[model samples]
Target: MKEATEGRLRLTILGGFLGSGKTTWLRHHLHERAFGRVHVIVNEAAAAPVDDALLSAADRLTLLAGACVCCTGQSDFLRVLLGLCDDRSGLADPSMRVENIVLETSGLADPAAILAMIQAHPVLVRQIVVVETIVIVDALNARTQMEQEVLCRQQIEAADRLILTKTDLAAPKDLARLGATLRAIAPGATLSAARFGSPLGLKDPWSDDEPFALPEISEHDSSPINACQLDLGDTPDWTAFTVWLSALLYARGDQIVRVKGVVVTPAGRLLLQTVRRSVQSPEILPESATPVEGDNTIAVIGRGFSQDQLAASFNHFSA
Candidate 1:
């Protein structure tokens, strides 16, 4: 971790179904001039590591797609993320100075589950807090997918920013209808749209006060399944204990659905995530160097577990 002065590496998670122009939305985040020293984690379910156009920079990018981000590769993601803070190899010259991390999950991934992984980590939750859960919806097939695929519906419902993309393919009336539907589903969020080839209207948020305050959730939206907090505190005895603990949880892989949290390891602060079953490496972050923005907090979600258990594990590592 770079020890950011403010304890902030404002993070944003981009979740959308397959080919919904997520990469397009991300390209805007990557090329913007103000987003200096940004890091990206790309997740895929295939073995072929496809290049991420959004992470256009050869050096600052880390791809984790092919990884069973929600299952098989959870630990691998954890190890690699912890390694990033320590590994000077592939990192940029300002290697230690890492700012925001943009996570690109698989088309079939579950955003909520992955978010829990990031919020549960003891270190990451403290440093790199999530600014928003932006779910990009495709105008064309979104309605059909939502109707037929429950996972698809969950993705849209769990988002803080509902981005409608691929508008070119949808009829004007259909697009308007879909947009209205999404607004109803997430009345609390700020809504917006972007076409694939067009420049996204979003400005570099780092230039201002921490990206708009976490979205205010309506009472009905207050459930843990969709709402989870990633808390970051002092580094954990992550050496062998954390590794063993991760393994124990991974062994029960099938039962674990989603995990997302910012974790602080002895090496550095990182973003941890799991979707479906595979996990993406915690995006290692440091605030010792960046300005401290706020207090540290981390939380994770599981299918049949208690938040107390999660809190207890993290408390065990308090400095």
Candidate 2:
């Protein structure tokens, strides 16, 4: 582990299920320029990373690829975090002090597990203080996911602020029901709604004047959820792809917790993201964004699906 820096560092975790818009919220935060010298740690399980493309230009961003931070990357998480801060040795430059650290956990991460790791680590306990655990919930799918996925419930139960993303697509009654359900699960958490990341109160953790309260670590069992990716040799026709996806979601969306990927579509480079049955409109990536070959891939993280079933679903669209 890297040596710890002398000054206090505020850390916040941006946690949510896949396709719940964690990255979108982070982009909005960066645009606000609310924090000074904020450093971001993006934990991704994909073979090809995407958030790095979205957040690379920020003050400082590091990608910890190939594992979920709450699980395989816990030690790596500490290492990268400690590395970002200058060691207390006077030899380190003064300008190297990091004011804040934001960690965006993978969609399937367990926030309690993350909290447990931090609370137990010796270096982290002394150097880093948690400001908030902001959990983004997809309004359209919250009820089903909360009821079906233990990890989703754990994340929500562990949040200091629970943000409901993509509320515009939900009907008033449905949104109301979702709110009631969330309150039932996490009555103490602060709730806010967002459409395209609006009203996102992401700020420097220390800005809050109240005494910081850490969320309780959930005691849910840590079970493995399978994440499978399929490489689409080329972008499939948008019309056909949507039709296929709609059908798939209609049939098995309950089993598929999250779907996300990049595609070089005829329209342009696009990012497709979804949680359960709520699929956001494809985001048009800037031409400067890292280019993906015709080898673009889509990842599905869920339960009850064999790898072959997942591959066949994507391959069916390919034909």
Candidate 3:
């Protein structure tokens, strides 16, 4: 927790793999006001962003959708950072200036690349001081993810602090092994556990546990993950759609890493999310909240699937 330079703003980068609970943790921290008078910038790989709707607790929020900041959206990301710096400089009252910023990066992003981008920039390097890099790890699915995705391993290696989410769902023995594995990967990172969004004390009863052997992932090992959006027209059949989604996950869960969307149902505005084959209970959004522009459209993030294929499959099942 190094202090920011006298005039520079402090920035914290929050990154994690797909379905790793980054948003959940961020939402909670924002509600708790963990970062005083902070601004939040959320990046989504999908064109239709859903996570931004859930993070309403920030004092000021910016959405950078349709690209990951590490690569395709690098220019936009830099522009936003520079704009914030300019805005702060223009403020005559030092008390009115925003000194802290939290960047919740898209799951596909690499924090290391982003840090390098900032350090290499002439203006940003002087205006912003990155205080920390916190990455969330999915306790339940990280074993499979780490073995399959090189990006996942890169995220862990770049973390200054690692927060293991879904700790309640994972067995104690498995949790110990995963903890050991993460330590092996990022020895310098401080590790802790959380359930849903609340911090939990992690007790490693199995002190003698061995780390899981992670195999080398080659360029040819898997298909690149992409975010594809599916439009559920104004009038969607909730019952039929549920069935189609369940069947899709059952058949292709391995390829479909994450699914998230907001939909207006008879019950209310429902926020839906799924990770692999596990479907979280749908949460109803506040009735007073403003409507999301992309309601009824879901973003499917994973490999081995296209938008057309998803649309056709839903149509066939619903028909």
Best by lDDT: 3
All candidates: TM-score: 0.55, 0.81, 0.97
Kindly list the per-residue Cα lDDT of model 3 for residues 48-103, writing each as its tens digit.
Answer: 99888888999899999999999999999999999999999999999888899999
Ranked candidates, highest TM-score first: 3, 2, 1
Compare candidates 1 and 2 on TM-score and give the better one. 2
Angstrom error of the Cα, residue 86, model 1: value is 5.1
Where does candidate 2 stray beyond 4 Å?
A: 1-6, 86-93, 200-224, 234-244, 293-295
RMSD of each: 16.9, 6.5, 1.6
Cα lDDT of all candidates, in order?
0.57, 0.73, 0.91
Quality of model 1 by C-alpha lDDT: 0.57
Clashes of each: 69, 0, 0
Best by TM-score: 3
Clashing pairs in 3: none
Error of 3 at 228 (Å): 0.5
Cα lDDT tens digits, model 1, 1-319, are: 1234364565567787654657657776566644566677787654333335235752377777445565556776666555554443345775566766667776656778766776787765665567778888877767755654566677887898777765666776666666666656665666676865354453321122222112333425422232234344443455543553476366644434445444455556555545434454555654456533322333233334565655565456443
